[model samples]
Target chain A: MKLRRIQAIAVKEALQIVRDPRSLMIALLVPLMQMVIFGYGVNLDIRHIPLCVLDHENGQQSRNLVARFAASNYFSLRRAAGSDREVAQALDEGDCGIALVIPADFSQRLNDGGRATVQALLDGTDSNTANIAAGYAKSVVAAFSAAAQLDAVQRRGGTLQTQTPVGVEARVWFNEALESRNFIVPGIVALVMAIVGAQLTSLTIAREWERGTMELLVSTPVQPMELMIGKLLPYFAVGLADAAICLGLAVFWFEVPFHGTVATLLFTSSLFLTVVLCIGYLVSVSIRSQVGASQVALLATMLPTTLLSGFSFPIEQMPAAVQAATFLVSARYYVEILKAVFLKGAGVVELAVPILCLALYAAVVVVLAARAFRKTLD
Target chain B: MTPSAPIVEAREVSKRFGALVAVDRLSFAVPPGEIFGLVGPDGAGKTTTMRMLAGVMRPDGGQIVADGVDVLAHPEQAKRHISYMPQRFGLYEDLTVDENIRFYADLFDVPRDVRETRAAAMLAASDMLPFRKRLAGQLSGGMKQKLGLTCALVHTPKVVLLDEPTTGVDPLSRREFWQILYGLRAEGVALVISTAYLDEAERCDRLALLHGGRMVHCDTPAGLKARMPGAMLEVVSPEPRRARDALAGQPGVRGVLLIGIGLHVHVDAAGRSAGIAAALAAAGVPVSEIAEVAPSIEDLFVALLDNAETPA
Candidate 1:
């Protein structure tokens, strides 16, 4: 492959890109837009859940218990219901995500130093938020009960150890609060690479065919390898710039912590970019129409990266067969690397497997893409 | 036709598309400094022949050689010496004409000094110097074709294969394109041009008349016209259509073609003019003028195709 031919193609492609500034601007900005949208939109933290309380006792102890639930951040007490009928009506009318009900003897039972039972009713429609809200509610009630038990112990002057015999201390390392944003924002970088890289390069060869320029292009002395490299070099650089922007948004804008070294990040991201760009090139050569090629590129790259790359769903939660299939998706390794680098302070040693897998995938697809273009019209 | 070796030659090359033969056993040789024309109607394998010569299409049989390179075995090697312009638009529309020319010069690895002089000369000859900064997409059809030729010839390849370079161009542009081609010929560049306009074939050093993917006649413009077995006579009549009707199957009449000027009647020999006059009189069609004329390549094309269609 002659460098002159490759340079010629690259120069022409650069002119084409510079001549149409709108598409380049869009390609660069779409990733940042997606990052912002996904960072704020796919938030997993469910806060300020509306709660309705039905207290039949109307006593001090019952009021204190209601105040405990209201003080927590997870629940926002909407309104107090009067009776059993009101409680049922509140739950039916979707007035609250969850409801708390206390019986008429609740103050008496608690004052007599005996056990008191209350009912916590929850909405099951939005199961994810409902589940999280249930956990939050349980923690609140548990804390309140512990305080009540300690008070009784102090009243009897019993040993403090008897109040809490066995308790486990849990510490979360990566995400201190186990925030889902950490999980979400890092994966957005992988998605941006998969989507924009493939979308832009997918139109290269197919556009030439659609515009009736490939015939003359192939008639030259340019080899397929030279042409592929020359056509893809500009887009590959664009993809890396896109990666930089998305990474900046993740770290500087959204404040997702990044712990990996810049070298490893760039190297691995370049590998991933190579894979997606090659995939787009292969599709462009196979499909002659730009519309068809871009659609197939989205299907082949964006869909897999979004759905099967463990971006939204955890790969460990997937079935065994699907987990095995995730191995084939190039973005899966990138997602793993993203999570590791962002959350675990993982460097090269901790990320050898994913890096190797991405490199191998890049190598194979590059070969396929290079071999895909033949000079013959047939 | 030259004493020296052929710079580009095809030996019995054939190309087929499934059940249809696009080019059948076509053979020709183009020496340096000659313009070889592939003259035929649409679907007569003109484009296919040009493509094979360009090394873009692989022949089903036989071989093509360009500048000591086996085109079938190594198209890339052959492409160094061959510049092909497709029948359709073959330029990047988003780029300016100058940029397009520079891009081709880069592709062909032309030196800066050579490219600068050559590109400027070509643009001046084609009257495209002022429009060099214009985007290729914004140019007129004829101008686009001219830019395509400039780009194709920028590399100064040994053999230039142009497929209907003026198919959709205006008549004036077509004449200009031919002038540029004559300039290339003067520079000793071998040109293989394909066109459906038989009148354009008159300018070629030699012509190949293709019909149904086969070369029915291959010779000079005058040589191919000389192959017509009968004489062509122009008849101007008051009722030309009726005269054509009366002379449809007259003896010694080969073909009757209605033209804008008059009816072009082909007779077997000069002596058969009396028979045509008598036939028109019997049908009560008054012939205002009757004159004998030399057959064009178009006339020879029709006559040869008719002969090929019939049995001995």
Candidate 2:
């Protein structure tokens, strides 16, 4: 491959990206837009669910129970119902996501040191939200039960130790608060790089075919290897720039933590960028029309990055077949590395498996992309 | 004359697409400082032939040598001396004219010092020097074809294969394009151009008449026209359509075409021309002039192909 030919191709591609409004928009603006959308908009964590309460007894115990639900950050008091019908109304009208119903004999039963059940009615239409809300409500009621048991023992003058006999203390790591933003922001970085990188490079070769420039271009002294290298050099730089933009926004704009070294982050990012660029180049080589190539590139890169890479959904949640397929999706490895580096403060040594996977993926695709191009039309 | 050797030679080159034979045993050679025309209408394997010579395609069953390099064996090496333009003017509409030329110059490894002067001269010759800064997309169809030519010639290739460069271009641009081609010939560049336009065929140093992927005749324009099977007589009458009708089924009258200013009548031989005139006069058509005329390239192609198709 001649370096001069490579430089020439790269320069011409750079001019085209600048001249085409569509390509320019994709390269320069898509990354930032995707980052903002995924970072600030998509949140997996369910919080601040509207809750309505039904009190059958006017006892202090029931009132105190309602107060506990209101004080917790997980639930906010939207309405206080005097009757069961009111609670049913609030749940049916979608005024509340969940309803807390207390029994009339609740205070008497709890005073007797017996089990008292408080029913939680949830909106099951949004099953994911409903399930998480149920879990939160269980924890809140559990905490409230523990405290009420202590109060009953002291009021009865029994000789009970103030300290609990057994307790489970949960200490969260990596993300101590379990903030979904910290988790989602890093994944968004990988996703944006995959989309913008693949999209921009997807049009590179296909545009030539559509515009009839491929005929003259293939007739030149440029080798297939030289043409592939020349075509990818400009896009490689653009991919890296997109990486910098998305990663910078993740750390500074969204306040996602950066626990890893800059060298490792940049190195791993470049590796992933190489893989995605090759994927786009391969799509361009296979499909001659620009629209067809762009769509196929999206299918090859964006779908895998967003769905199977554990970006929006967890890879482990997929079926066995699809989970195994995620290994072929290069974005899975990059997403793993980004999340580790951002939240866990993991370095290269700690994340060697994913980095190696990404590097191997990049090597294979580079070879494929280089072999895919020929200086012949047929 | 090419004193040393030809810059391009295609020998028994054949290509097939699935079950369709696009080109069969198509053999032609282009010497230096000569313009060789592959003359045929659409689907006569003109583009395929041009492609094989340009090293942009693989000829299924033959040998192609360009500048002494085996095109099929080492296409990339052969490409250094060849410039191929497709039927469509392959200019990047988004890029400026100067940028497009520079791109090709770079790809062909045109030296930094020589590239400037070469590009400038070609642009000036094509009268595109002033529009160098304009985007190629904004140029007229004729100008786009000229830009395609300029880019193709930027590398000073030994053999240039142009595939219908003026197919859709305006008449004015077509004339201007020929001027640039003659200049290339003056510079001793071997040019092989494919065109369906027979008028363009007469200007070439030699011509290949192709029909259905086969070269039926390969000769100079004068030579091909001389092979016309029968005499073509021009009848100048006020009512030419009626004159054509009157001579339709007359003895020895093969075909009659209503052309501008007259009717072109084909007969079995030159001896039948006088009989056709008499037939037209006897039919009471006012015949102003009835005389023999040489066949144009189109008429010759039709008659020659007809002659080859019929059983001798």
Candidate 3:
């Protein structure tokens, strides 16, 4: 309740951080580096897929189809071979992510007006990118088939017309370019906030408990609420700094647009940080051992933020049970807010639910922390 | 309207952890401005009892009234009256002396101007003023304990709960630490200190002897010593442990304890020391000397515990 007491504890905690260089590095530098690493590393928007080919039908028709694959930047010709083993080897070693094979009787079939099927092999380990690559490859092959039909019709001296009355066109909004860097950078920022806010407060408070400093603090007339608030403030600032670092790198180095107002992002980010810090404090207060507290915080915050938050994996695409579990994960809502504000340029009206979720998370965690901290000397 | 009350009172306090009983139905009271000591060996429930009184732990069954407030029902308000230093006293190792002091003052909600002046006086009083700017982590063990005490006392609480505050420090620092506690007592502060050192218990106005979650005895250290059931004889022998086994619970002998390489035998006051020595000699236990001596607090503790162990 008292501001001065809270300020004093916050200042002392901040001083401890400043005194330890390793903690500072983990708090500030690690988040920025993670943003950049994840920004480049996790790409959902597949492009320029290296596609090797085994074109046994080396006739004019096959050569034209190869040219068509080259024209579409989706598939780059990495190798042209007759050996199935060599192409298979390329796919196995991941040297090429996708491969295409044309049958030996490709030109003869086309001349006879028969349908010739081309086999497309793709690496399905990374299902998202692989799925996108397979779609693009199929579309390019379909274009080649249509062009062949047109050529045949022109040679017959006939005007060609098809009756397809209606069709649907899919347009991607917000990130028209579908840049992977744009979508993942905001999630990395959320992860960084979770790590910084939770890990620091959890370790520091639990260390105090282990070393017997908490007993000293408790014996004093300092109110429990004042002590709890004071402990959270410095880490909240650190969380803010981590957020700034993530946004800076995302905007400056990766060129991801922050289309929404900075105020909204910072406000929401602060609320999320408070939630994490309170969770950390609660863990520290109840556990009493530094190692146990740190482990709890790491497991509770980091794992959920990574796996259940829809940060890298889409929660919608997950199983029904997992979708239900994500409701309890505060990071899921924050990640949605971060992505929306950064990419979709969503305002308060659109982000109110996530914001309210964060506020509620902060309130619940803080209350639990205070409750756990109320104890006796003996 | 009422007469001055005792500074602290606990009635039938007991704490249980699963099946293990830590502090049995314990009851005690400390009059105003007096030093009350909880003296017991390891696992005697000294720390647990102190923690309950400090309002850090809830008793499974009991009432702890400190400074006219129920510790269990009104912990936050009770916390305002007592300063508790756990065994470690949890000092901020990385923070400077002045910073650690200021931190506790702030935590206690001490006013700003009062904190500055009080912190200065505490440092001066403890002779820690010279190292005000030095990090607590870098200070010697004794200095850290001093700093911890200063922080605990910064808010001027009515009662101070010190849980083995001098467990690990060197002898010189232990003396200095006790001196500080003495000074606090001089200021009309009620002191409840738990210690394993019997000599330190002698300094308290009254002492509570606890063992196996039970209060073996509660009185002044001297009174506890005087109540030793028999005359204590210092026995010099070649084998102290062997002599202890031979003299222990022998007819007319109440207890046998090892003090250094010598055994102290508590015997019936009217019994003959020479006769006991002769019996030891007959038993092939070599005895160099046997002389009657006053019972120490530890001697009394060993006697009381030995008596409690035997079928009465």
Candidate 4:
């Protein structure tokens, strides 16, 4: 409760972090590394899918159809198969993700004004990539058919043409390009903050216990709450600094947009940092060992923050049990706030729920950590 | 020195760990300017008792009044009047010597002027002024203990509790550490230090011998030795073990203890030494010297344990 006492502890803890190179590396370098690696390494946008063609007819129409698939950036033509067996072999060997099989009677049927059919086969091992590739193929074939009908109409000298009754023009808001990095980089701020704030503090009190400094502190006039606050203040600053670094990298380095003001970001980040640091302090108080505290902090903060915060995966698609468990993770609410402010340009009004949740989590965790920290060795 | 009111008192304090009793109805008082030693072997509840007095642990039964404040009820207030140094000095290995001392100064909210003066004085007294900028981890074992003492004495509390402060320290450092403690006592500070060394126990103004969570004896060094039940005869023989075996459990002999190249036989009276010498000679253990001598603290401790076990 005393300011001088708290300041003393904070200064000592900061000195320790500065003196220990390993802790300094964890606080500063680890976040930067995580951002760079996760930003570029994990890509959800699929491109340059290899495609194989079986042109049995070897006609102008078949070659034109194959050129359309090649012209699109989504697909790259690997080879032209002479038979169905060869196409199958290429698909089975994983040489191509998609195959276009043009029948021999395709050009003859079209010249006779009869409909011709083509077969498109896909490798379903990686289902997400397979589905997206199939959709692109379907769109390409539809465009070709429409253009062919228009040519036929002009040749017959038709004055008018029928039009589809309905049109669906889908627009993706927030992220116009639908780039996954925009969403992921913002969420990385929360994850990095959790690691620097919680994991670093998780070792502070435990280190004191191991080194026998807690006994001296407890024997003095310092209060438990004072010790807890002092221990957390330095790491809280480190966590905020880490958050700022991540924000800069996301906006300038990774090219993710930043729609919110620095004030809002700092406000939300402070609340989230408080919650995580309290969790770390509580773990240290309970375990009271350096190695044990580090392992528990990783499991309690980093794992849950990355997995349950909807940072890397969608929480809506998670099983009901895990969905319920996400409520206990403070990172879930922080991620929501970051994504909203960064992508949606949402203000306090738009992010009332998540902001309130973060404040509540901070309050509850601070109380619990203070309560768990007793002045006695017992 | 004239007797005065106690600066620290424990009234029948007891501590239990599950079903095991670590401290049983312990009672003691430390007055101003007196060095009280809690002398015991390992697991004698010396550390536990020191922890309770320091207000870092609560005794399940009875009361601990430090500086007239009930430690269990107002631990924070009680802590302001006492400084505790644990078995390990607890110096932050990463912090510089000056930083560690300043940390304790700030925690105790010592006035800036007082802190500067006291810190310089302590450093000079402990001969640690030259290593103020050095990291604590790099300091020698002796220097570390001195630094721990300097930090603890920063606030100049009324009572100081030290738990086995010299257990790992070298003999020269142990002597220096005792010199600093003597200076503190001269300043009218009450000190309660625990140690496993019997020689160190002799340095205390008074000491309590603890065994199995109970205080077997509590008196000054000379007083405890004076309580030795009967005459102690030093027997010098070529065969010490055989001499001990021959003399032990003989007529009028209380106990026989081996004390480095000689046998100390406790007897009901000084007159019994002649009978013991005859018994040793009959058992073919030749004795060259036999004479009555004053018992040391070790002899008293062993005799106390023997008496406790036999209950005579």
Number of clashes recorded per candidate:
0, 0, 11, 0
Q: Could you tell me the TM-score of candidate 4?
A: 0.94
Cα miss at B96, model 2 (Å)?
Answer: 2.0
What docking grade does candidate 4 earn? Answer: high
Tens digits of per-residue lDDT for model 4, A1-378: 889999999999989988987878777888899888878887788777999999889898888888889999889999889888999999999999999999999888876778988899999999989999999999888877777777677788984474667988999999989998889888887887787677878888888888888888888898888889998888888887888888889889998888888888888888988998899899999998899998998888889988999998899999999999999999999999999999888888889999999899899999999999888988
- lDDT, candidate 2, A288-362, per-residue tens: 999999999988877777889998898888999999999998889998999999888899999999999999999
lDDT digits (tens) for residues A226-314 of candidate 3: 77887787777777888888888878888888789998888888888888888888888878788999899888888999999988988
- Global fold similarity of model 3 (TM-score): 0.88
Per-model TM-score, in order, reads 0.95, 0.93, 0.88, 0.94
lDDT (Cα, 0-100) at A36 in candidate 4: 89
Please state the CAPRI-style docking class of candidate 1: high
Off-target runs (Cα >4 Å) in candidate 3 are: A50-57, A83-134, A141-172, A318-321, B1-4, B235-251, B260-263, B280-290
Better of 1 and 2 by lDDT: 1
Minimum summed lDDT over a 10-residue window in model 1 chain A is located at A159-168
Better model by TM-score, 2 or 4?
4
- Isolated chain B TM-score per model: 0.96, 0.93, 0.94, 0.94
From the highest DockQ down, the ranking of the candidates is 1, 4, 2, 3
Docking class of 2: medium
Give the Cα error of residue B288 in candidate 2, in Å: 2.0
Clash pairs (backbone) in predicted model 1: none
Which of the CAPRI classes, incorrect, acceptable, medium or high, describes model 3? medium
Candidates in order: C-alpha RMSD to true structure: 2.3, 2.6, 3.7, 2.4
